[model samples]
Target: MAQQKVKRLPDADVEAIFGAFAAAEPEPKGELDYVNPFTLLVAVVLSAQATDAGVNKATKLLFQLADTPKKMVALGPAEIEDKIKTIGLFRNKAKNVFALSQQLIERFDSKVPESREALETLPGVGRKTANVVLNIAFKQPTIAVDTHLFRVANRTGLAPGDNPLKVEQGLLKIVPDQYLLHAHHWLILHGRYICKARKPDCWRCIISEWCRFEPKTPAPKGS
Candidate 1:
């Protein structure tokens, strides 16, 4: 098999590229549906290795039953499991969800913690989940590099690194502070819709001009 060549981008160019992308689609948001920090945390936890569409499907019903820590704990693990049975790792997720809810009630007055360390202390919340909660819920400047963001960052030369943490740190270092709050959502939406995993629709991509990847998808015939 041939080695897949990766694209590289300079800090200034990367900023301009993302800036243009954002200008076109101003105000991007997470696809996952949620009401608050607690619901957002739960949704991100369930979203691991699952599509946003799938996670939203499960949470739509689950949220109705238990939207808050107090309500979630009352719903219990078994019921949570039953409601989210269709999702992957429902058993483990249910256990973590329940444990985290209990932890919230016991430790934080049933409120989602504001700090990263405190948030990560919950059963299922990890660095990525904490980052999402921090960025989306608290309006903090953070980038949560999931697979899509990782690939987009590397392939576009935006903030290339070997791992998600490094990429996230690089993004924080390079991305303009003014755009920090919504940068993650812009990259995620771009990666999901245009620079996809399988066949990136480069022809229609707005950033193709700035991309370092050679031989980008050609414009459709007779367009």
Candidate 2:
């Protein structure tokens, strides 16, 4: 038998879905810990293949010592690696952090850039990272498609795409303007906790009604 095809949701359903999310959590926040835009950028860069919890554990002390570009540059990659060695690819992440910090100081006067193009110019700053920085740090209405967001977008048929950029553009075109600013956070959180990759807990999902995922996961036996 052929698998059920995922269908794109209607505009009204999308509105209702995000409306539910907004009503449930009016102000969703990213889990990564950060003291400032600079720290947030560094944290995201470190989170490439790492969990937010893991990143937070390392950054707790690391941020205290070097939360600024100047301070991070002073720390050096070797010392930085020592701080975040618990994470995967710590050595490379440390180098990127150090190099980007230096670039920030040399080019942007130690301030995190507002434009996506400028942010992407830094080492280890890709489209997703740049979008994240723009949205969270600079308050731009950009969606940064991480793994969670990517899965949720496809699974829910909210903005299905073969790649992150396509889904991001689709979402930007579909999501209402009022919800665009926080859509990244909302979708990411939902996918992380409820719309899980293995088995989405649709029973408790706030927006499950509007979601188009076939055969929604039922509550476990005798809950």
lDDT assessment of candidate 2: 0.93
lDDT of each: 0.87, 0.93
Strongest candidate by TM-score: 2
The regions of model 1 sitting more than 4 angstroms off are 1-8
Give each model's clash number.
1, 0
Per-residue lDDT of model 1, residues 1-223, tens digit only = 1114565577678778878967897788899999988999999999988888999999999999899999999998999999988899889999999999999999999999999999989998899999999999999998999888888888887777888998899888888888889889888888889888877889998888888665687777999
Shift of residue 46 alpha carbon in model 2, Å: 0.2
Instruction: Give stretches of model 2 more than 4 Å off.
Output: 1-5
- Which stretch of 10 consecutive residues in model 2 shows the poorest summed lDDT? 1-10
For 187-212, candidate 2 gives per-residue lDDT tens digits of 99998999888888999999888888
